[model samples]
Target: MIYDFILVGHGLAGGILARTLSEQGYKLAVFDTFKANSASRVAAGLINPLAGKRFAKSWLAEKLVPFAIAFYQQIEKEFNVKIWQPLPIFKFFSSVEEQNTWMGKSSNPAIQEFIKQVHLRLPFSESINQDFGAIEIAQSGYVDVNKFLDCLLVALAQSHLLIQEFFEFSRLNLNADFITYKQDNNTITARKIVFCEGFQAINNPYFSWLPFSLNKGEVLDIKVDNLPAECIYNKAVYVLPFGTDGFKVGATYNWREINEQPSAEALTELTERAGQILKKRFVVTKQAAGIRPAVKDRRPLMGWHPVHHQIGIFNGMGSKGVMMAPYLAHNFVANLQGAKLEPEADISRFLKYFTGI
Candidate 1:
């Protein structure tokens, strides 16, 4: 029996796509191996409207953040699970000049709604070094990715829509109408097979040529006493409140070290950075590393293969997956149903790469 779609990789992209398609009344199957080092597994799942050192609003943040909140809230109500933590993000200024820069940008119409408060003196004064103060951003929060994924997996399993296995590209056969995959003795056919593999896509023969700027990130879980638990703190690295008195400190970016193993050098670097910014004492509990599926142009990649019309790709979300996935997934499925997609996200933007310009 042929299905509407066969989704590969059950990370954020795959999960969202699967759910979006299923909700649209399409018969679909999802393939996932549940790798430990996948970006979604290690990501803090931050949804920040205003981000980065420049304190500029994220691309399409106004639309994406609200869509994500509504989407996750709907998921929570349907699944009876707790995963999203809606809270403000406290971005600290490195110097008075940086504070002035923030104040200048705060008046911009695009950024006004997300600015909850500007503090000359931070709320948490004792446990943090805030010489230049911090700004509390509204409509910012984090999604516990592990919990969210677990909830999705359980829902998919109950319906027998999830396949727990690795996808081998060698056994794939692409046809004009459908794509067939030979798994052991059984065969499965689908109208379209979408690859949602994260950084692993770097090795996918079908998508390997799509310029991917894979970056490795290291994060730490720590227990900090006397640290404020009300909001996410961003200085050198982000300090997110986790369990009781627990915080997640991260992350160090390394374009060279894309391996899964946590590096000692990264740990030291994070420790020093956290120490310089955090006045509270903390103990490291865990360390993790994951490779980000970033693109050279910093936009998501979505569209069919130039030659294989039956095969498609939806990836390259980078760090903004938490905020962008819901809206993008909705729009992606819309594109499949005859609506045009934004050119920035459409792989057609890079057709020159495949068409031999």
Candidate 2:
């Protein structure tokens, strides 16, 4: 079989990239291993407007948020699915100095537009220590990535473009012109191969040299009687309402040990941290862990392979895949369609590894 492009992995990067390329009228095929541990399935898909304890604006929030908002809305209408939700993160404040620092930064015209002047009074039915008010960060939300993947795979399958088997790395044949993979009696070929392997890319032969400071994130699923059903509550960890009687609370970002298994230590940490935040006691419903494809530089990595131009990558989204994928994917598809590349995400800047820059 032949296609204009073949995408490996069906997680956020692969799914969104495929959609963008398809929208631009590109003929593509997608191969997915459907690994249960892929970060997309385990993610809570929170899109935060601010980052760190001082409540600084996330990178490119002014531009990325608007694009993501419109993009998800269009997808919902086109596919008739509830993929995005507007959920405010009540960014927890720990110290008066920290609060004052943030308050000062919020006044900066550069960031003030994203941050609002408030007395720090926000409603929380549960009890959380708030000497100063929490910042009600707006234009922040989540995507039901799992649901989006399911619907997108089905949609692509209907078009005869999705294959469910795991992509075997040993069988991959990469050259300057094409990439091919074979399993059982079938073989697939395409002019270009892009690996959106998420954290698994830590093992990709081409991108291993990139500084991927991987971290393990663990989250909890719990059912409560009547918690804040609309807001994402935060103290040390975030309590995200998942509809019905349950909420998804997480996450512990640990760099010391990176593996795809939920640990009891994480469960205790999250539950205890959450217990201190919530006024009522909640039951732990589920626990899962996945490694984030985080980079030390903390940016999405997009570019053709250093040697093999026919190969490419769209990983290193870290925890912001929901927020970053649409914006970057659009650019990625555009570059493939004869558009110039964005400087920050362009991976060729690592010319030290290239034989020729």
Candidate 3:
């Protein structure tokens, strides 16, 4: 039987895309080995609209945030599993200048949509150090990425839609209308193959030409006392509230050493930064590292292979996969059905690099 789509890599992107296509009445098979230290497994699952030191709104945040929230909530209702948790982000102001800048930008209608409140005097002064005060960002939260992926994989496995193995490029045979691959004693066929292999895409012969700027990031989970559990606290480093008395601190970016091993330098950096923010005693509980599948221009990669029309990619989500995957997955499916992809994300932008074209 020829499946409508065969997805490679069941990480965040592939999982969401598989669900999107399946709900649209497409038969699909997912290929994955569930590798450890994958970006999806190590992601903090933040959904912040405002990003960077300047606090500019994320690309397409107005549309992506609402759509993502609805999509995750719908999945929860259908599966009866808890994954999406909405929480506010308290962005601490580093200096009076930063506070003034925010004060000025808060009046804009676009920025106002995400601003819950702006404080001149530090809020939660007893526990946090925000001398210049902070701004509470609305419509912010995190997804329990591990739980979501695990639940989805289980359902897929039960339905015989998941193939727990790596996809070997040499075994794939592409025809004019469909593609076939040899797996053990069986031959699996699919009309189209979409690769969502994350940073590992760099090794894929077809899609490797796409400019990938991968980065390794490390996050630490800690148990702390007296820090507020109501919201995520952020300054230089983010202290995300987890279970009772626990917080996930992290994310040191290291582009030089792009591997999945946690480093002592990153651990020290995270703990020290977290210490400056949370004045209470804390104990490190866990440390994780993963490589983000970032692009040079910092946008998702989507679209068909320039020469191989049957091949496609839906990857390079970087740190925003939790928020971007759902909406982007829907959009990608729409593109497959004759709609246009968002130009910035379309791999067509790099068509010149594809020698096959």
Candidate 4:
């Protein structure tokens, strides 16, 4: 069957692109294996305006956060599911100096909206050891990514738009304007093909040459009584409440030995770190690992293939996929329709590598 687009991978990137394309009345099909450790499936889906050790505003935070909130809220309404949780992220300061730095940052008009207040001490929980107090961020929350993706998957299947199979690069045939995929007993042709394969793109013959410094991250699902369920608690790691009693504590970023397998060393590290902050006892119930599709410059990769104009990619969102995907996906859709995306995100920045110059 002829289609407008064929998307490879059904992670956050693929899912967002699919939603955008389908909303625009484009006939698109998705091919995915739904790997357990796929980046999107394993993400805690935190959408924070201020990030990193310095607690500076995230790149394009002003644009990405609002779009993400609206996008996820829209999806929630369409799917009739509770996915977007507009909660706050309470970042604990390790020292007085850091707390003072946050106080100064909160005064900036550009960042004031996101900073609810810088706390001198966490009033609710003595279990958390924030000597220098914490800063409660406004308009920050975690997305129920798994639930969101599951609902989308079902909806796509109901509409015959999802194919639960691994994409084979060898079976893909690209032309000047269209591409064809030869599967087991059927062939699907599309005007354009976009790869949103996450870290697996490193193995994709088409995009493998792109600079990808993938990192392995591990998280543990634990039940901690003292931690409040209302807001995300962040220190060395984040304690994101999943339900009334369960919290997701993560994550260890390992540059080497990157894989989906959860490691014992990481488990030990997390438990120890969590212990330092929590005065209450917690039990590790489950562990998960996934490779983040990060890049050297920490910007997303989007745009059509330099040589194969009909081929494109929407990936390299890294840990911020929860916030970045929706907005970037919208921009990507616009670019596909003859508009231009942000210069930094456009894959054309690396066109020199593709051109052998």
- Name the candidate that leads on lDDT: 3
List model 2 lDDT by residue over 215-298, tens digit each. Answer: 999989998786657778777788888856788888899999988989999999999988867778788988999989888878
lDDT of each: 0.86, 0.80, 0.90, 0.87
Which candidate, 2 or 3, has the higher TM-score?
3
lDDT of 1 by residue, 145-189 (tens): 888988888888876467888888888888878888898978888
> Lowest-scoring 10 consecutive residues by lDDT in candidate 1?
348-357
**TM per prediction:** 0.96, 0.92, 0.97, 0.96
Off by over 4 Å in 4: 355-357
Instruction: List clashing residue pairs in candidate 4.
Output: none
* Candidate with maximal TM-score: 3
Error of 3 at 276 (Å): 1.7
Q: Please say which candidate is ahead in lDDT: 1 or 4.
A: 4
Q: Model 2, residue 89: what's the lDDT?
A: 71
TM-score of 2: 0.92
* Per-residue accuracy of model 3 over 195-307 as CA lDDT, tens digit each: 99999999999998999999999999999877778889998788998755688997888899998889999999999999888878899999999999999999999999987
**lDDT accuracy of residue 189 in candidate 3:** 94
Pairs that collide in candidate 1 are none
